[model samples]
Target: MNILDDLKLQYKLGGIALKMIYWNVACFLVSLVFFYSFKVGVFDFPSWIALSSEPAVFVLKPWTFLSYAFFHDGFLHLFFNMMVLNFSSYLFLTFFSSKQYLGLYILSAIFAGVIFVLGFNLMHYSGAIIGASAAIMAILVAVTTYSPLMNVRLLLVGNVKLWHVTAVILILDLMQFRLENSGGHISHLAGAFFGFVYIKLLQNGIDMSKILSIVLDFFTNIFKKPATPFKKVHKNYQKPAERPVSKIVVKDKKQQQIDEILDKISQSGYDSLSQEEKEFLFQAGK
Candidate 1:
């Protein structure tokens, strides 16, 4: 297959993590066209799309809570966030389902956005934020909370406990809590907090992810088209005595043999097939 077809196939088969990466990358590319300012060399995201600290703007555009997580400020910002996202997704999916992974990502972003807005408003500050840092932190912290002692190998540090990595990140965020981009850091911590809470509640048999699923299903049903009812037909004409024979496809002997072998394999597995059958199937494949 060509490169585009290959990519389409990969996307169709890949898990939620890969799909999330694709979404983030696609959003970044679109942002570069409309949000990025060439003259100032910085992204100028609008209020409707980016998560704003002001209550007034957010109250009108509540969707920004989730939308902002997909856009990024710069190429480097997108690159680094995606890198960490892939790493965290790997660890998270090791112990969780893809549906949970997606639900956590979306819910965490919304939770973090809310916290960011609340914290900024309390401090009498105003600014907009974008990027998946908050969601990525949630995934990382969630997995680390569940498997603190899990071993993760770093590029130069070798193998280390998962909690060690999480702690370092948390400490850095805390140290810079009041420094540059405090709002961003606030959202990060909020997402981390949500992640921890999510695991705790899950241990108690409370699945927050199901909330998103229910909401989605409700909306889907609302928009879904109703099936048309079957109509009864009246008998208007008599049946013919002899109907013409429809065309029938006849397979060649080689193809017929291959089909038999495939059917056998499907029923009893490849190992159950005879040596002659295996060789015939292999040659047919080539």
Candidate 2:
């Protein structure tokens, strides 16, 4: 099929992380087109746009802090970020739910933006940061934290524990603190820290997904009518005669058999059952 169709297929089949990477790439492309067509400066792109004209070192725009992670200034920048995002996200989705993935992505972006801003302010760095490297770093950290002993194979390198990769990336970022793109490095570290914290919190059963759920429920309740009070409507309703002992016992026995069958289906594969059993399980699941 055509390229767009191929991409659509990939996105449909890929997990949440891949879909996120695709969104970032699409945003970068759109920003590039705007930059060229509208004569907007390349540095004015979403990722690294100047925060303030008067303050050269500040990068505090509300949207820039988060949106910057989705924009790239060059082909190489986009390529490496996408590669890391794809690989790390694959590992991440294999373990976490979609809500967890989305939460991590958003929090990672925010943490990265904050770190970038803080670093620029503290170190007097003047350049704006862009790209998803920080967010990808966060994903890498989360994957490694969740599955520390998991072995990952690089193209040229042999299989290595996931934590080793995490360690190396953190060290590299630490050593590169004085580089011109120090703000970006700091942001990556921030994202990595957030990922680590997120996993730790998750291990303790603290889910941030509830926050979004509550907000959605509030909005839904706002637009919906209140529940009506229950009314006791009484008519000359006569109680039915008691079921026969044998019939009642047989029906109860049948229900017990159905429950047992359903339990078995849940523990084993549906293919383990016959057609009649399959129908029974389907009806029960519904």
Whose lDDT is greatest here? Answer: 1
lDDT of every model, 2 decimals: 0.88, 0.73
Where in model 1 is the C-alpha error above 4 Å? 228-286
lDDT score of residue 61 within candidate 2: 50
- How well does candidate 2 match the true structure in TM-score terms? 0.68
TM-score of each: 0.80, 0.68
Q: Which tens-of-lDDT digit does each residue in 112-155 have in candidate 1?
A: 99999989889999998898999999999999989999999999
User: What is the Cα-based TM-score of model 1?
Assistant: 0.80
Candidate 2 lDDT tens digits, 120-194: 767665556777887788889998988999998988999999898889889988988776477778788899998
Q: What local lDDT does model 2 show for residue 181?
A: 71
Q: Which segments of model 2 are wrong by more than 4 Å?
A: 36-43, 46-60, 209-286
